[model samples]
Target: MKKKICVIFGGESTEYEISLRSAASIINELDKEKYDIMTVGITRGGKWKEYTGKVENIICDRWYDDSLKDVSVDLGGADGALIVYGNGKLEKVKIDCAFLGLHGANGEDGTVQGMLKLAHIPYTGPDMLTSCLGMDKAYTKIMLESAGIDQAKWVTVNDYDRDEIMKKVVDAEEIFGYPMFVKPANAGSSIGIGKAKNRDELMSAIDNAFKFDRRIIIEEFLSGREVECAVMGKRGVVRVSCVGEIKAANEFYDYEAKYSDKVESKLIIPAEFKDGIEKRIKETAKKAFIALDGKGYSRVDFFVNEDDGTVKLNEINTLPGFTSISMFPKLFMHEGFSYAEILDRLIEIGME
Candidate 1:
């Protein structure tokens, strides 16, 4: 019998829609001849529903109606599905492995991973510790710095310091200077990112950022080329895809640029760069992946200062965008791996 792979997407995250797109990409690429595919959708409100149609159909158009299903597991029950309160009835669905496509909080931050671990189900992507570490910018930065990796200077803010946050903002300016990037420390797709060119912008950005996350981070913006590398694991060996460059039409690569067509963001596979710089970036990306104890697959982003040739680690997406046009898949595709092949490889490695 074919193994059932549950591709989970959506959550209480700003990237919920993007997660849907990512799941669609994964579902399209999964080999139906080898494995049985099950698409599960988690709404922004945290409700879980089993998608009836194929992933592509659901992504191209919202095909699945709200099932009003609530996914829950009982410790007393076996590893199979316990109950899903939907259609005014309780249902059970068996899942062999989960191909996680959920991004941002409650999903990518290790919560779902922990749940799956407890349920004794095999899931794709990083384990709990790595997922948690990758979600928090502050923790990831500290770990990267300790590993001798370069990153932008930054300051963190939490809810308790609302009154004192202004003072901390001023201090951040002194340390990282103006033209800073204020963002929710744990958000992805640049959901709550703002560029602050002055004190007013800085304060406003901080407030806006706090709206998304209780903890925020202010980092010095580096004027440089943005590049990303995709890494995949086979057994204990990790291989890096050819680097890709991102050219965004917006002030920065924000949600619009990422998901919508409003902003043009081009991807140049095997990005043209000085041989030495390219080598360094590829090496640094692999090192960053290992430092975070990442597994299955991940995308490591970086900012390279062309003037002095300094490269700074931006962040890592444990669960990156997987659309055909998305950077991670594009990188691997350019490196001669078809989309279906990439998905198969991920599932195979995950089986280990």
Candidate 2:
């Protein structure tokens, strides 16, 4: 019997469209002989809907032309099967495990993971604690630094006091100097990030960042090559993918550079590095993953300072992009793993 794998995507997040792209890629690569794939779409408003056909078709071909109607799951039902109703009829669908492709808040911030845990269903990617920690930039940094990882100097601010935030910004300027990066501590997709080159820009960036999240993180901008490593599996047997370098066309790698083709950002698989740099980066990436108690898979980013030959930890994406053109799959592909093999490994690891 084929195991029923529910590939969940779309949520109330800035990365909703990105998640759809990832879902398409995964569904296309999943081995049909081994698993029964079910495509589940969650709207931006959090409504659960069951759709027909392959996940790739629904995602890439935009086949969601007609709504499959709304579905309700009776928690009391056996094995938590979803009760689908439409045209005055009903059916129940049982889900064995879910392959989550949702990104950003509500989905990636441990909410969905916690619900799945309570539902007694196994799912892919990190557990609740790791997901929550990885979602919050400020807390993640604290944990990383405490574990002796070299990360950029940062200060966090909440909505408590504007005056206090101003004072902190002044102190940050004094300590970290000019050209700082201000970002929302809990948001992803670089949705609310700004580069502050002066005091005025700093204040504006803070205000802009606060618009998206309650907590804002301001850090010193380190100029270097932006590199990332993809990690998979649990502790004691974790595997790291080849390093990939990101070259953003914009002043900083913002939303435009990430999703839009207008902004030119090149991805270099097996990034060019000096002797021992790649090995050191892989080692540090694993350390950072262990530091946060990460599980399943995560992409650890870094900034390699060419001038001083130093590597600084950037941030970790617990659920990184999985589109065919995305870096995560590209890295593994460059390392001799095909897309289908990557998907199989993720599902295999996820089941564990």
Candidate 3:
């Protein structure tokens, strides 16, 4: 019997469109001969729908309108049919496993993962605890710092009011000075993220960040080449991909530079490094993965100074983007694994 695979994408998160593209990419790559595919999409308003249509529509954002049925992942009563209800009709669809291509908040932050766990369903990406750790930038930084991992200077703030936030920003300025990076602790694709050079920009950035999440992270801007490494594994055995570099089109790799076609971003495979730097980064990437008790696949990002080869871990992506131009797949491609092969490995490990 062909395995029934559920590819869940789109979410109430800021990275909703990105998830659609990622789900399309995975759906296109999965071999039709080995699996029966069901595409599930979550709207920006948190509506769950079952979309059985052209993969192109999913990628182009047209599937959102042509969605056929409303759906829910039924975790409470599991009789093999994991998804229930559609088009106002009661329907039960048994799912063998799920490939979560979601990025940012709710979906990537352990809510869906916990649901799957309770449903006794196997799903791709990290487990619930690891997902929470990876999605919350402040917690990830704290855990990694506790493990002695090198990271950028940062401060975490949770006050919702503008006045309270400004006071926290004042404290941040005293420590990190100007040109700070402000980001929502739980957002992705650079949404609700900004660079502040002074008090006005700082205030503006904080307000923008609070729009997406109550928790915000402020960090000192580190001048270096943006490098990333992809990791795959479960249990104790982890494989690290070759380091890749990013050249952003904007002041930094913001939302526009990440998704817009007009604003181009360059990706350099097998990023050049001094004798020990590459090995160190690869090792650090693995250690960071293990330190966080990561399960399934993850992508660890970093900042590397070209002049002195200083390395600072940026963040961990439990469910990294798998779009055509995403670095996760590109990094592994350089190591001789095709995109399909990478997906196969992820599925196999996720089921294990």
Best by TM-score: 3
Q: Write the per-residue lDDT of candidate 3 for residues 210-242, one digit (tens) a residue.
A: 889988999988988899999999879999999
Q: Give RMSD to native, each candidate.
A: 2.0, 2.0, 1.7
User: What C-alpha lDDT does candidate 2 achieve relative to the native structure?
Assistant: 0.85
Query: If both were scored by lDDT, which would come out higher, candidate 2 or candidate 3?
Result: 3
The C-alpha lDDT values of all candidates are: 0.84, 0.85, 0.88
Q: Report how far off residue 4 is in candidate 2 (Å).
A: 0.6
For model 1, name the residue pairs that clash.
Answer: none
Tens-digit per-residue lDDT, 48-93, candidate 2 = 7776766656565364545576665446655846567778888877
Query: Residue 275 of model 2: what lDDT?
Result: 62
Task: At residue 39, give the lDDT of candidate 3.
Answer: 86
Q: What are the runs in model 2 whose C-alpha is more than 4 Å off? A: 53-66, 72-74, 77-80
What clash count goes with each model?
A: 0, 0, 0
Candidate 3: clashing pairs of residues: none
Order the candidate numbers by TM-score, best to worst. 3, 2, 1
lDDT of 1 at 242: 88
